[model samples]
Target: MKAVILAGGEGCRLRPLTNHCPKPMVPILNKPVMEYSIELLKRHGITDIIMTVHYLSSSIRSHFGDGSKWGVTITYSEDGMPLGTAGSVKLAEQMLTESFLVISGDILTDFDLSAGIQHHEDQLAAATIFTKPLDLPIEYGVLLSADKKMDKMFEKPNWSDLTKHSINTGIYILDPKIFTYLEDFTHYDFSKDVFPAILKHNEKISIFEAEGYWSDIGTLATYREAQFDMLHHKVNLPSKGKEIAKGIWMEDGVTIHDDVTLKGPIYISRNTIIHEGAIVGPQTVLSESAIIHEKSEITHSILWENSYVGKSCSLGGMIGHCQIQDHSALADMNDETVNAWREYTKRDS
Candidate 1:
């Protein structure tokens, strides 16, 4: 079966991080977020895939060219302008001749797609929308059903107005004929326009309640939660690197001097170095080639590739490629210096 990955979102909520990388390319556990999506699709035996790209299209194209590295054939549909979710998939209508699956690229989930497909086929519905129960439904589009039929759909409704906690997971098994409802080069979203229109016409749309982990990493808070979830094994993501010590994973060429303390549940990527007297960890991630100087301390933080923490510096929270001077905290760094650091750490790839 063909799969359509909606990867074109600008990710305005995840600023700074998304400033350099596309939303799909955002790092979770030192791996691009979409990489996990591709792996998940492959695990379900769905190899023929189409990815829709808009912002930083070339970067995504370059990173996973032809998808051969992942043992899948990848076709890209680039948008000249921002096409809404459904509109973007419409651009690839020719490739999606059969029933297909649609999923957001920015989300991190291990939802059983195979089961979802089975449910879709058994019901013989025109479209099947994967639904999950959310404790807080205000931020998502709520799906209301009665007698096994969709009755109402509300997008980001107030708490007082909510009747159902089941929300759309942005994963769908769609019939190709659904393309007929969308126009080319126009902005149209599945939740805001297409799905509602289908319900209005009394078309059969199945709703499958997802059973496994699902997280839409749309904001920094969710991103951090996803990381912690992975650390706790709440989600079944591939191991980031070699587990050299208990709760501490490190890649090849990692250098650590004596007297450096590394707490558990941390990932140190390739070629990173922790100098003497440095204390790292307890839910921290150091990206490739990061340098933690002598006596520096980092806890509950994520450091991007080639980041430098000077001697005696203390850092917590999300930090990119910025360099912290000796004895300096993150707040001591100015915006100009941070921008310069980001530019310096920019990857040519």
Candidate 2:
């Protein structure tokens, strides 16, 4: 079966990071988010795949060329214009001119696609929207179903709608004919435009509800959380971090000087250095080429590539992302810096 993966968004919310890398290319435990989606599709016998590309499309094409490595034949649907979710799927109609599954590139889930497809077939619906139950459905679309059949979809609900709610998982088994609803020369969001039109025509838009792990790596906090989830084996991956010791994963070419202290759950990426007397991690991630000077202490933080932590500095909930001119210091700061009561002043300025 063919599958359409929407990987076209600019990922505006994850700026600074997304400024350098595409959202789907952002690493979750050192693996691109799109890799997980592709693996899941390949595992479920969906061999032919079409990626709808826009911003930074070349990076995606370069990384997952031909999909032969993962036992799938991949195609690209490069969108020359900004197409919304439904529009992107519609734009890929030529590739998916048959029954196909559609999923977002940035969403992380272990949802049962096979079962959803089966359910779609059983109902003979034009579209089968995968539904997930959220704690607060106020910000999401509420799928109303009775007797296991989706009757209607109401988006951005109030308290009343929250009582009988199921939310769109952004995964769908869509019939190619649904492409007819997509109008030309406009941005058409799936939830706002297409699904509503389908319901108005009393078309069967079935719901395939799955109770499984689902996460959207949309922000830095959620992205970090996804990494932790992967480390704990909540989401299975081929390699669950490299083992430098019994319970440590130090990246290749990392330099750890003598007398440095480290606790478990540390992931030091390639070319990072921990100088003498530096204390690092009980839970920390040092990105590639990071440097920790003597006696500097770090915990519960994520240092981006090429960062440096100065001597005697303390960090908690920090994110250091780059180096300063002349390599004399790092552009480092922390939650402590943001807290006004700490009375800490910026000396680098």
Candidate 3:
């Protein structure tokens, strides 16, 4: 079977971090977020992939190359223009001559794709969407289905009816015939355009409620939460690093001073250094080559690759590529903080 990974979204909500890197390249546990999606596809025995790339497309191409390392053959559909979701895949319509699954490269999930494909095949529908039931379906749209057939999609409907349905996961299995609904190489979204057109024509559209961990990581908060989820074993991925102790993971070349406080549920990636008197608190993630100076305290925060925290500094929230000064503190992160960081980065570079 084949798959189309939608890797083109720029992730406007996850700015500051997404400023320099593509959404798919966003690091999760020191690994590219899209890499987990590739690993998931490999586990389901779907090795042939076509990734639709835009917005720092080179980062993806340079990192994965031909995808041989993951045992998948990847061919990119590089978009010269911003071809939304459906249009991006439409660019590679010729390559998808048969049934194919479409998933967001930035999303992290351990869903059973094979089972979802089997459901789609059994139904022989025009398309099958993968969905997950939210514990509190407050913000997401509700896709109501009857006997596995899509009934109606409501945007932020009354919560009284929320428990009866599942939210769309932006994962789908589609027949090649569905391409007829999409215009050639034009920008279109599956939810806003193509699917509505299919529904207008009374074509078959099915929904499969998947059972597993699924996170879109749309915001900076969710991005950190997803990594914390991994630390807590909420989701299982064959991730990097070794768990040296309960809830504590360290990768190669990690150097920690004996006087430093090592907290559980913390992940220190390759070549990270923690100096004397530093407190590596719970839910702290230090990416590759990140350095924590003496007596610095990092709690519930994330430091991207090579970011440095100066002596006695205290921090929280996401820190992008940075060299924070000694005794500096940033406890709350908002849009203003993000813009300031971006400007700081611009000047620092």
Which candidate number would show the highest lDDT if scored against the true structure? 3
Provide backbone clash counts, one per model: 0, 0, 0
Better of 1 and 2 by lDDT: 1
- Model 1: number of clashes? 0
Query: Candidate 2 vs candidate 3: which has greater TM-score?
Result: 3
Put down candidate 3 lDDT per residue, 47-93, tens digits, no spaces.
Answer: 99999999999989999999999999999999999988899999999
Compute the lDDT for candidate 1. Answer: 0.85
Ten contiguous residues minimizing lDDT sum, candidate 2: 340-349
Give the lowest summed-lDDT range of ten residues in model 3. 340-349
* Model 3 ranges off by over 4 Å: 155-163, 333-349
Candidate 2 lDDT at 240 equals 30
Better of 1 and 2 by TM-score: 1
Superposed by TM-score, candidate 1 places the C-alpha of residue 5 at a distance from the truth, in angstroms, of 0.7
How do the residues 83-173 of candidate 1 rate in per-residue lDDT, one tens digit apiece? 8999999999999999999999999999999999999999888899999999887889999987555677888988887888999999999
CA lDDT of each prediction against the hidden true structure: 0.85, 0.76, 0.86
Query: What TM-score, computed on C-alpha atoms, does each candidate reach?
Result: 0.92, 0.83, 0.91
